[model samples]
Target: MRTPPTIPAHLPRLAARFDLSSEDLGNCAERCAARVQRLADLWSHAGTPPGQVMRTLRRTAKRHSVYMPQKDSAAECINRMSDPAWWRRALRKRFRAVELHAIQTGAVHRHASPYVSAKALRRHELNAARLAAQMDGLEAINQTTGEAVPMSDLIEASLANPANRRAALMARIKGIETSALAKSHVGLFLTITCPSRMHPRHSMSGAPNAAYDGTYPGRAHAYLSRVWSTATRRAAHLGLTAYGLRVVEPHHDACPHWHLLVFTPADQADAYADNLRAYALADSPNELGAQERRFTVKRIDPAKGSAVGYVAKYVSKSIDGEGVDFDSESDNDGRAAARRQIAWARTWGIRQFQFFGVPPITPTRELYRVSAAGLPGLALPELHQACKANDYAAWLATVEAHELRLGVDYAERESTRYRGETTKAISGLTVEGGDLTQPLSLVTRCDTWRIEPRAKGQAQAPSERAATGSDFSPWTRFNNSAPIDAKGLFPSDAPRAKTEKKGEEGETAVRGSVLHRAPLPGAGRGDWESARPAA
Candidate 1:
């Protein structure tokens, strides 16, 4: 029997090592499937000619001013996405190093987590009865190793141990807690569930009556916004706007509920909850008792872990996220309708987490660099501004706009990179810069610095450079790569070379073979080299 899977945050560093016994080897298929899916997503433009994307980029590169890098270099940048370094940079642009660091260290032991198995599910009487009748058909015995593995053991490891994902999420949650603690005296962890479906798929089985629709999330968001507004009006000093976290929840019907965390002054806590209830009642329109449990809240205990943890706890455990294949209908049906919900959510690009009115987290890239060298934050204010805007270009602007308080140990350029730096300075920055996960600006998704200090005769202003949207796109690089299959099947999608008829004389086949043709008298002689086929 495999040991139960555990989450990262809940475990200490010692317990995080990869253990194969705890892993299941069944993910091989899923890995292959995921690779195919990635290839398909990356090569979606397989049908589009490369010239179309490249033409514009080339034009932009040739016409771009001094501010713009060379056209070939720009094209090469997109081409470099195939490199590991470029992939790392891409991920770095999207996430803070500290958050990634925690995830890396926590999930250091990457192995197939034995999160699902056949024997376990078969423990139930009905399932066991069904299995006993079909035991001979399983062919569970290993052909070579002769191990009697259960058939369930071979099921693709589609579902991961929720703990593996919680590692990164919890790290960010701790950051959120730090900000909440500093900015607001009071914090509430809360949940808001969507109403029972109006026309549920399984009205008798308690499936939603009214399924999640395109307008549902918008309506829910409007209701939540109104409730928060009502709460604010009810209490002047409540400071409900101090900090807020609304994590979009995915359900079986592909709808959303939300887990939210908000901060206020301690004295206004009661007033906040009461005003919320009142708004919930008032919005009932023609509704009766309880108003559908409108909302629920709990106090945060700073002494424990973090207030942010309570709300983010469900985020990584949910089925709808980065790893899911929203387009793949073959996704496991056993995961409680997660595939359908994921597909539904994917169609809309539903955000996993959203923040409103919270103090913006600062960019610590410089801090990370400086700290890596054991230096202090010399440009704190500028860092804060860039962080507040969550813009990479703005961050570069901040890098140039400020002067640093240098010490004897400081160097001209700090060695900050996406990975492998450990210094107390970085640790301090991680503590101070909480939850930098939100997509705060356009630059947040980009790795390259779009803004540079202006030259006397600069080619383009920073704002203009930002708008140019790079004419030489990265997608054209796919032209250099092997084409992906339209159907995304492994082995099956691979390109097959055309072959000539076997009977026709061709370079592919040996003409005077020992099996059919008369053996040549000097076939093995070095002197007969001139008679070799052109191949």
Candidate 2:
């Protein structure tokens, strides 16, 4: 004498959309009643209209893999549709922080988002402080020599620090300057921005744009990347060769823009500028402000300042905001803007800086890690010496001798870890023609290291002196650190070390590894740590 289950009126529509029977939809709705009610509550709380909510639900249903022909069976679709994660991901995709907050708290809070939202900024700071606290007493142990170094010290030696990264970028720029001077090249500064449709919010007023195409920050960044790639390819087609750095920064509303500092032959500068401009404006050519505001170029006059000096503030502002005062674009102070920039970048997985048309810098960085004792008899002895000496100008000369140029001459061979092996690792270097047997093959990384937590009340290890023939050491005060892993364990391209036993749901298990330092944006890409300046 039990009553039959009641189905929603929209079951017919959903069944038709998913190509399933109404009976199946009715059963799913009944079994997943709590999830359905929760979603309805969320939509109601957020004041989403019925038509819009239906559209969102339909889109979510269409996103399942089973909807694709011959991809997955309808049974699999039903199983996934019953999953809580399916509903959760859809909601997350449809709503961002503001709407999610409204749904959860039942109260609307005004978010005066400038470059990044206030809540996001606070969360980023808290997480950063927490990570710093966790790494306070940890130490890195080099498996090769049983050498113990403070974790903090290793970080300073590596490119993880903003100060260190800034120094490295400047040195490379100066190196490029030397080459440009030697080749009689001129520096050109360029700025490129996305079209109006990609920006969801207006920069100045912070109002939502009615004409926005619903593009998120990550996709907007992808569009910019595509535009740059097309422009660079066209420049190559026209025989315009330029080499330098590009920095990506966020506008007030969090849309990304590019700032390029490139050096090209004097004869090709104007042509290069024209090529970039033409490609940048090719999309939305007639949109408002597209003509005058889209792309801009300026000549870098050495009399006024070096090319590095011209972009020094930009590098500083993006990384640590060390000497900058205020940003006119975001109307935020240096430190604040920097925090927003970091948060924006981390949130969207965007690479903030990149160099082009340069030889790989991995070999040089690996040379730095080579102990003075290992220096002798290393392959490419002069290249090793120049890198160890921190002589970029000399390093470029050595690299050119091998006929290596990024894209044109060589491909990178990354370091790897064999299966089931945690301690043994190989470092990455460049290979000519993507062939290891080629004469241009150079194996730069020679050391293997393991990281473990320092025992309580352990004394810090003494610093290692700079390499022989080098004027200074970046690691003299601290010692070399292993590359960062996600779990703060030693460097690995694979999953981090785990606890003795995997934790069951809602249970705490003591993890053997600590959290490694965070990586630069774009986790999958190689060559983040080092790339050589153009010769």
Candidate 3:
């Protein structure tokens, strides 16, 4: 039995108007009640109408009751919305002091906050709920064939396997090295950074930066994105074509910077660098070290290392830290650093790596699902031969040729096609631009799955399997099984039931039978051979 929490004396009328009572407050917890009281006081102090404040509280209560219909959940919802202290504790696992401070102070309300916004966290929580449902042995039943797979298993397979992701990135890099781009173009390793004001802390000392402008990591990321867009737009106006990988990484202060491994015509590399620098310093141009640190371009020398080698560490560090030894930003080992980077990216919904001036990865993945032979009649038919051959380099060439023939901006076309889809999963590709009308769609994912709890006896616990010594060799679906087709060789030694008339005799007889039937070591042609019947 739980005790009812005591509501503040001043809030009695407000609580009464909302039809809430002390018994109902019991579910809210003392801490939650206090936070709600605090928010109510804040509302009153702001000169809000008494009726409006009551209505607002009731609305928050009702909105939250949809998911949690408990008596006290409404009060808890109010606490979640207004309490800065609660937000700090809730986000402590993923973000620290400076970041949390920014989140609490910058937002006008909890609904539209920055740096891991309420919406993003709610989305993550929903995903976590789905994952939890899967972990609870829920199976995704395919409606078509009536086949079912563990949702957890599907999730694991769909997630980017670190090793495979790194391998694919390296393969793409190698493809670029051997292509025409490598012949007439120079590889430039460019670094674009946010202004000093955006970073909250110093990189070397881990202390707050004196020039910090109190910008959240998410906002700073957006600023960097805008700057890059401006620079790229300028480059486009100059007719300077560049293509390659872009890696976004966080500074020690949680501000973002970009590392681009770009291949551009040798003659235009300097011009591209100049434009990037100009835009990078467009804001706060007079800040200390702005000129030197904002944008940097390094020309890759083939004699030193391949362009892939130059960006491999960045790719590895961002993904799984396969070949990375240390991370200077976090002062941690490769794997630990990678974990932090991934956390930062997920929290802020930032894309860590992107391939520019190439066919979008989403479309390529969709293309792989469809029959290559059938692609000749589909949109972007130039990619059909490349898909048939499974050659990435050839695909790159064909996409470029196709773009030239279409006379449409490839990036814009792909971007437009990808919009208006649900964020849950990529259903398929929508072909836009070129001769394609309005948006010709392809239905690649036709399977519909519904998650349901595992039926009794459908799955076995590991402990149960271990105790039984069960080996579903060449037949049953145990995860671990023997290679040979041997079955029933190791019979169970479960005790036999006792007879009512001769319990002791029955037990003795059963024991004797079990021992007689049990296979013994070296019983074939060794000492036990004398016990065997005549051949």
The TM-score of predicted model 2 comes to: 0.63
**lDDT scores of the candidates, listed in order:** 0.35, 0.56, 0.53
lDDT of 2 by residue, 1-535 (tens): 2211222344334433543222443454454535545666676588866666555445645553222212133333333444544443332232233322321221211236555666556656765765555554565454434555555555545566776566667667777887888889999999999999876566666655666665556777898888889989999988999999999988767777999999999999999999999889989999989988889898999889888778988898888887789877767688777888897776556899998987656555544443333222333556656665556767787667654432212323343211121221223333342112343323323222444556886533323322322122233213222222222211221122222222322121011111111112111122122222223
Superposition error at 336 for model 1 (Å): 6.6
lDDT string for model 3 (62-155, tens) is 5433122222433334534454334333332233222334332332111233123343344445555544554447554544347555433433
* Best-to-worst TM-score order: 2, 3, 1
> Model 3, which residues run further than 4 Å from truth?
1-98, 102-136, 180-183, 373-385, 388-390, 402-443, 456-535
| Strongest candidate by TM-score | 2
User: Model 2's lDDT to the true fold?
Assistant: 0.56
Off by over 4 Å in 2: 1-111, 371-379, 401-425, 428-448, 457-535
Ranking by lDDT: 2, 3, 1
> What would the TM-scores of all predictions be?
0.36, 0.63, 0.58
Task: Supply the global lDDT for candidate 1.
Answer: 0.35
lDDT: which is higher, 1 or 2?
2
Clashing pairs in 3: none
Q: Could you tell me the lDDT of residue 311 within candidate 2?
A: 90
